[model samples]
Target: MSRPFADGEGKVGTWVNEFKENQDVTYACLRPVQTTVLGKTAKVYLTPFSLNDYKLEQLKHSKSLSEKNSNYMMVCQKSEPKKTCEEILIPKMKVIPSKAESTLQKLSLGVHDESNKPGHKSPSAAAILSADMESSDEDITPGVDDFSGLSPYEKKRLKNISENAKFFASLQLSEVSARLREMIKKRQPPKSKRKKPKKRENEIGCRRSMRLLKVSPSGVSLPAPPTAPMLIEDENPLLPPGPLEMIPENADDNHELFKGFLQTWAEMNKTSSKNMEEELSSLKSYKANLNGMVISEDNVHKVTKGSISSVALHPSETRILVAAGSKLGQIGLWDLTQQHKEDGTYVFYVHSQPISCLYFSPANPAHLLSLSYDGTLRCGDFSRAVFDEVYRNESRSLSSFDFLAESAATLLVGHWDGALSLVDRRTPGTSYEKLISSSMTKIRTVHIHPVQRQYFITAGLRDTHVYDARYLNPRRSQPLVSVTEHTKSIASAYFSPVTGNRVVSTCADCKLRIFDSSCVSSQMPLLTSIRHNTITGRWLTRFQAVWDPKQEDCVIVGSMAHPRRVEVFHETGKGVHSLLGEGLGSVCSINAMHPTRYVLAGGNSSGRLHIFMKPGSY
Candidate 1:
């Protein structure tokens, strides 16, 4: 058997056989012709027939065929055709002139052409040589385009150069010498323009009146100062000048212009469905006494501590458990139902360092969680009458913690080292069930949304971050939202009990910022910020602004601007009330509201507890 192979030429073919191994394979050239095969037109190549040695011997051995029959050639098997040739490209060296070189050439040609003109005289060889061999010390001028993208500094330097040129052009030789001498002299420092300080608030109305004394030939008569425009009522052409409806004698009748007043009034009345509406309505009434709640001088209780760090009121109204934590690691418990005697209060030493935060478990009212700077988180169970250390680590200091409403046994604790750990009470032997590195700064406080237990917020030294507890994993590092509007350290961040849509954070920048957390934006929008005085006391602890559980619109924060007072602010940034008196002798930086009652308690730096009650409360 022989096989045929196609070479570079599509028409050339070579045949190889085992019997002719020593002989060179014969090749045939074929001509391509276009012909119709089946129903399609195609190109076909046919090889011409030719008899080789093998075919000649076969004819001689047969002895029956003529030499004409020996002319027959056998066709070999079909083989593939050679492919088309491809074009090849080779790179070559080429010279291209830059813009600067081309510009220089053009300039040189123009100069040469000008010199050769009939009206121009050609320079001497010496002068031409001198022009070609420029001095190395001479400065090179820049092109116009070079100035287009000059930096600000370069542009300023150019402007100064232009100004100096103008100045020199306007000055004489003597004046120039004098100016140069002056410039060479040591420059005197520029005088600072000091701004006059604004007058104090108390001096605004006490300014002395300036009198105008006129000397009318006798120097005795003084005319009144010139008067400006006075306010005068005029008739508006749009409104007919009829006798004004004084007080609307017919109370039920509505004017044509104010016909929608009744509809708006009805719509407003329909919205007064919640308790918040009633509270707001009460404040609007003339008889309403927001000041009915005040710290009485006789109601002050003193604790044996230097500074009160935190305070929390129990959720029971009948039997109030006012727990106050101090920097001396003492927990002062005062039973408000008992008499105001020294022996009536119970004090306990639970931590070695100052307390940071105190929270009463919502699931178990008898359980009180206390966090201290000593890196211990203990729960004082009233039902068991014992205090148990829930968690403590020597390396990581516990700053704050809150029970997750999603699971009562699950607690979210914030550490001083910027990690938020999820502690499962059921499995206490293991370390943190899940730890999340929320920030690079220490977490100051952690608060769970009162309504959405699955979501919690951690107030770090840098910013406040909101995370979903359900989606929290040890590997998860991102939060749902981050609020960084605070310019200083966030002392505390809390969600309103009535509605979790609003979050209030007290910042060390002396501001109480209210944010609308319910907004769909990535960052919650700040509703309002109230100006507060957080730096009044050097030794006093920072105040934490807490939302009144009774009214989400009201925020209560310790007032440092006043000698002794607590300020209450509405979400509109208005000061609604202030509990100020001589009883609060020092600055009160820690305050807590009675969860179920309309009572308030504040602790000062000296550990004096001040209590305020509503009307009729003894």
Candidate 2:
């Protein structure tokens, strides 16, 4: 019921009235309508006549249409055909100016005119309009401004744009913006030069402790006793201890001199023993009187060559004998009471590596024990004037050792490979009584409970554990209590010196933690965690927090803070005192307190010893 009409140009269109029911329709004559397209006016003819009539009209115009179709088909084929300019009918287009074009014309003319003025169009604008209408399409060129053709509105707009450009140029904002961009680029690193993350390989096997390996016992040998050189009256009195020398050929005369030295050391052991009642009373009444202590020039001395790794105070009340060990495997013994005699110091090369621990036997002050990373534990016997080898392990290096009972012969030693060995000096061979593997990677420190001698604690990596000596299994011993809140490697852990009711630890996370161990169980509650800097870099020894032997509630540790002082804090995280002096200008990484005296000693990385005591106590 519908029909489509096609014009002479072959554009088909639908007639809307074709769908009506009325059939009485009359044909209308052709007419033209005026319409504008693409800024050009043209006439379009529309006829609703019969299809036969439409075909007849198309036939009449076939000649002209064929020529136009041929040209269009050539263009579609991507080919150009030469034609005379008279045959090409170019449509007349109306010119409409844009704001940018008008403004550009004003800028080219370098003039400004008021748009609000009442008058006819400017003569210059009229001239440019006439020229644009008369110009041919082929004759027009781009980027050519008509300087003489600008209206008042365009001239005003051009004036405003020029003023803004001049203002910005005076401010020099473009140069400042360029410099800021350059600075930003320099501050940020380029993506191409950034470091790429390393790919981690899959671990193949589980880690096994070195103690589990089966190996033969290491050979143990005793070297000749080291002897000090005789001092001459004319020698420099402030000189350090001379190197050890071989005994003279006259062994008998040398033996006599050694015996006299032993006798004098015995006479210096004048510590009076107290009963349990008096000892408990004294401990309860002990207070840290830090204000009364002073560090003077006379109390400071260089005891060793390399950094001091460990320090121990002798328990003799009649004399002040401080012993220190260095990373260079040297042991220095300083006698403060005999400062005027031979410089009051003696240095001995006893080990081949760094000494990790030093302690004078409490049962007999004559025997001083020292452990070194060279896998050897030696005892300096003043009575015999010899360093006797007590234990050695060639398979693994020793890390820490402590006395297990009142008798100093029984010892508990920890290895770098997470193994614990029970050693008895009375035994003949280099073998241990019992060896047990632990659940740690490296045992950094070990401490036996003061009252409960059978209980001990070990610190390694990021964990600290307490174990009982009676239930240790040879394969894998279980811990009685474990403290795992440490976020970094634990430097050291120790029990209270008097009652063993609390444990204090120093961690590389810059925190000092204390645990209440009044009743040892699987869960030991954390008492306090104090924010203290414990990060001693590679060139210095690690900081360790140790308890005051006289006061069970107080703890002492070296500081990395300015003014180079040592800090003492109570168990509740309150600062008790900070020992500062002009003579102490370096970080004291290792510190120790006298067991029965009011004396404290700190050792620095430069091997210097600083002593703090009552001004006239020495």
Candidate 3:
């Protein structure tokens, strides 16, 4: 029922006129009513257009369409193209001259200075050197023409000079010129001219005028002209020409010598001073009631299969993730917030032997790392859901490892055969450097300084070694510093996390040592040494003293005697706190602290993890 509309006109009504044809529907032109009546209004109508008027309207509409099309076409023709770099940048660039290239060209051309010209008399070597030394340019002339008629020795010297100039031109201009001047000065012969003392004119005049006094006829001397008194002692003395000998003299000994009495005064007071500090700490702990309360506990294995060797907490304590490794090489991860057996736990079986250490990456809290006695180190990234084998060895066993927090990419790994290696995560198969020694029976642990990332401390058979990571080469046989104070095997040694002002070590000799590490270049004074009971049962796990990240002055360690507890001691040999009573149900052998929060995690021999937060936090 619909027809397509035309562009020129739309017809909705039909009309038949004198010169027109009839149509089905034609459009009616509208006009306003000229007048209106009250109560009944007449319908409005429009006057039909004549032929002339219709023609005029059509011309006007056509004229407007032509003007718009012309304008559009003109604009399209006038547009400019986009400019490019070839037109703008090429003209602005200027050529720059290189100093090295110019110098090399000059040396190859064999140019000579004015001093070495054929017509001019050749100056002495010292004079030529002095003149050229004052100039900015370091170019040397070899006098090539003079060499044609000279002896072979002189020709050799000129050839050397030419070669030297070429060598200097090839190096960095600034540094090479300074070094060349120093070498030239050292090669020059010493000057033979000494500064002649100014002659005394008055004395010469006196001698000339009184020449007749020398032949005194009557044995009488003529009166000498009055002269000024010379200060013989005030004149500068001549320095010895050659090396001065340090001749020993038998001068009088005024030192007060102490007769054969052994210096036991210092040794006698050292023991008494240490005992006094221990008694003081005991009194402080009794009055302060220092104790920690546990908030929760989680079991690594449902039926307690094997002892738990290590435990680690994520850096971010928001959603706590407790990862513990067991003696049978099984690693269990639990979401502490969920606390369910099946739904909240994830287990990994990566090693064939027992696990030695477990830790979370400092750079990423979701990444976990584990080391085992089977000589394998592995990393698991939860974000990517992939496992990566970081390192492996067929002969040596990996015991423990620590990440360099500063680099966030390097790891220091210790082995059972007294070997240490620095492994980069990006290149896991090859080690960057390795250290080994015959005297080192076993490497127990390796700890990097918290503040100085370039240095690390290690505990071996009965000694501790400190090394600079930058200078550690495979062929180097010595460490930067060594500490040998324990009789039995040393368990672990660490620098203080805050300020790195002190070092604390736990040894199997039943002793804990504190040293002043504030200045490593000087002697490290032993601040205090305390008797600790480290003897557990034959098959028990060895206890290690770990520094609390929150407090630099206090350290926490497990107890092997009496009630089941973990004790904390001040660096000054004072007791800080004790986790005793029903709060801690079993003995804890391995522990770690939350980096930024007041929370602690511990593990026991029965495959369990114990968590303790601040008292008010629970």
Give lDDT tens digits, candidate 3, residues 24-120: 1221100010011100111111112122211111111221212222332233233333432223222211121222223223332332443243333
TM-scores of all candidate predictions against the true structure = 0.53, 0.59, 0.51
lDDT of 2 at 570: 86
Instruction: List RMSD in Å for every model shown.
Output: 35.9, 23.0, 43.0
Cα lDDT, all candidates: 0.59, 0.68, 0.56
Displacement of residue 391 (Cα, Å) in model 1 is 1.4
RMSD of 3: 43.0
Clashing pairs in 1: none
* Clash pairs (backbone) in predicted model 3: 12-25, 12-26, 12-27, 13-25, 13-26
RMSD of 1: 35.9
Clashing pairs in 2: none
| Model 2 bad stretches (over 4 Å) | 1-263, 276-288, 429-431
Candidate 1 C-alpha lDDT tens digits along 1-618:
343322212122232243246433332221111011111111111212222211111111111111111111111112123421010000100111133223323333444544454333333332222122121111222322243433322222222223222333333444555676677675867789999999887764643324423545564666766997875764211122111122221223335422332222122212113344243334454114456666666668876365899988776644545778888777777666655444346566777678888877766666667888777777776544456766766567788888875445878888888887887777655435567777447788898887767788888885988887767666546788898898878888998876588999988888889999875236688999888887755687888899887677788898856466788888889888888876677777888887546688888888888888775564
Candidate 3 TM-score to native: 0.51
Best by TM-score: 2
Best by lDDT: 2
Candidate 1 C-alpha error for residue 17, in Å: 99
